[model samples]
Target: MYFTFLGTGAGVPAKLRNTASMVLTMPEYQGDAWMFDCGEATQHQILHTSVKLSKIKKIFITHLHGDHIYGLPGVLGSRSFQGGDDQLTVFGPKGIKDFIEMSLSISSTYLKYPLEIIEIDEDGVIYEDKYFKVSAKELEHGITCYGYRIEEKDQPGTLLVDRLKAEGIMPGPIYREFKEKAAVTLPNGRTLNSSDYIGPDKKGRKIAVLGDTRICQAAVDLAEGVDVLIHESTFSHGMEEKAYDYFHSTSSQAAQTAKAANAAALILTHISSRFQEDDHLLLEEAREIFSPVYLAKDFWTYKID
Candidate 1:
C-alpha cells in the first residue's frame, strides 16, 4: 500500500500547496485507488502524478467544508471523460449526497459509471469486505467531521512446503490443493489436514486518517495502535489557543494524540498556508512529542511497510 499526497494546504490553496487531497493505492486492489478529501484543484494535482482518474474507485469525504470537497464535482465529472466505467462509491457525512447530486445536476454532468453515495449519519463500521474493514468516529471540529480507521483482514499463512516434503509429498499440482482445501488426499490414499502443514497467520496492517479537528479522545480512539496516523496540523505549537478557537489542531496537539494512541508513525498534513517558509517549525514541534513523524508535502508519496 502507498499514500500519495496530492495537496496538503489548509483552508485555501497556496503557491506551494493546493488543498486537502490524497490517494491510497493498494496493490492488492489492482489499479483501483481510494481518494480522501478532494479539495480545490485536486484534479489538477492528480495531473502532476501518475494516478489515473479512471482508477479512483472510492472517495471518502472528511467533511462538507469547501476546502475539503470543492474539487469533488470536477473529479467526478472528469472520471467520465477519462473512460471510467467501473462503479464508484463515495462515503461522507450527512448532506454530502445532496451536495454531489446538486453539483452534478446543476452542471449537467452525467457519469458513465455507476455512482454510489453513502451519507454517514452515525459513527461505526461504514465499509467491510473480505480483505478489509473501515470504521468511522466523530471528531471535535467546528462542524461534524470524522476520522476513519482502515484495517486489513489477517492473511492466511504460507503453505508449509518443508513439512509437506517430510510427509513424502513432493512439489506438484497436488500441492495447490493442500493450500486451498482443508484436506488433501495423497496417492497412497492418506488424507492430510492442510492446517497441520501451514505456518502462523500474518497480521494485517492498520491505518487511521483524520479530518480537521481539535485534540480529542475520538481521534486517539480511531488511531489506536495504527501503523500510520495521518492527522491535520493546521497550526504551529505556540498557536494552541488560536487552533482551539478555529476548531483545528496544532502540530503539538497532533503529536500528543499520536503518542496517546500509540501509533507506530505519524504523518502531519493540512498545513496552514501562512507559514510558507517556517513549515519546519511544525515538524520540529511534532517530533518533540512523537517519534517518526512526517510532514506531508504535495505530490509526496509514502509507502506503507
Candidate 2:
C-alpha cells in the first residue's frame, strides 16, 4: 500500500499547503483510493496526480473542522460527473450525514451512485474486508475527533512455480488449491505439501492516522507498534504552553507518542502556518525524540512495503 499526501496544513489553506488530506492506494484494487480528510481544494490537488476521482470508494473524515471537510460536496459532485457509479461509504463523527445531505441539496448537486454515511462516536472497528480492517479511537481534541488505525489482513503464501515445475506439476487450477490449503495430489499418485513449496506469508502493515488533538494516553494505545504514525504536530517544543492552551500537540509530544507506541516511523502533518517558511526546526525538534519522524509536505507520496 502507498500513502499520498494531498494536503498537510492545519486549520486553513496556505500558499504552499492546502489542508488535511491523505490518499491510501493499494495495487490489488484497480485505481482504488481511500481518502482520509477532504479539505478545501482537494479536487484541485487530484489534478496533479495519476489518481482518478472515479476510483475513490471510501472517505474517512477525522473531524468536522472546515479545514478537514470543506471539500466533500465538490468531490462528490465531481465524481458523479466523472462517471463514478460504485457505492461510496463515508465514515465520520456525528452530523456528517446531515452536513453532506444539506450541502448537496442546497447546491442542487445529485449523485449517480449509492452513498453510505456512518457516524462514529467511540473506539472500535468501523470497517472490515478481506484485505484490511479499519478501527477508530476517540481523541482529546477540544471538539469530538477520532484517530484511525488501518490494519491490513494477513495474506496467503506465495506459490513456488519452480518447485511445481520440477515436480512435473504444470501450472493449472491445482496451483490455486496448493496456495490455499495444506497440499495437492496429482494424478500421478504424488502428493505435494504446500508448506514445502510455498514461501512463508508476510505480515501485513499497520498504519495509524491521528487527527487534531492533544497528547493523550488513548493516542498512544491507538498507535501501538504501527508501521507508520501520521500524527498532527501543530507546534514546536518551545510552544508547549500555547499547544496546551489551544488543545493541540507540539512536535515533541507527537514524537513522544510515536516512541511510546513503538512505531517504526512517524510523519508529522497538520502544520501551523506560522512556520510555513521554516519547517526545518519543527522537523529537527521532532527528530530529536523519534529518529524516523518526517515532516510531510503537500503532494508528498510514500510507499510502504
The prediction achieving the highest TM-score against the true structure is 2
For model 1, how does the per-residue alpha-carbon lDDT over 52-166 read when each residue is reduced to its tens digit? Answer: 9899999999999999999999999999999999999999999999999999999999999999999998999999998889999999998999899999989989999999899
Worst 10 residues of 2 by lDDT: 24-33
Off by over 4 Å in 2: none
Please, what are the lDDT tens digits per residue for candidate 2 over residues 40-83?
A: 99999988877777889999999999999999889999999999
TM-score for each of the candidates: 0.96, 0.97
Clashes of 2: 0
Clashing pairs for model 1 are none
Among these predictions, the greatest lDDT belongs to 1
lDDT, each prediction: 0.95, 0.90
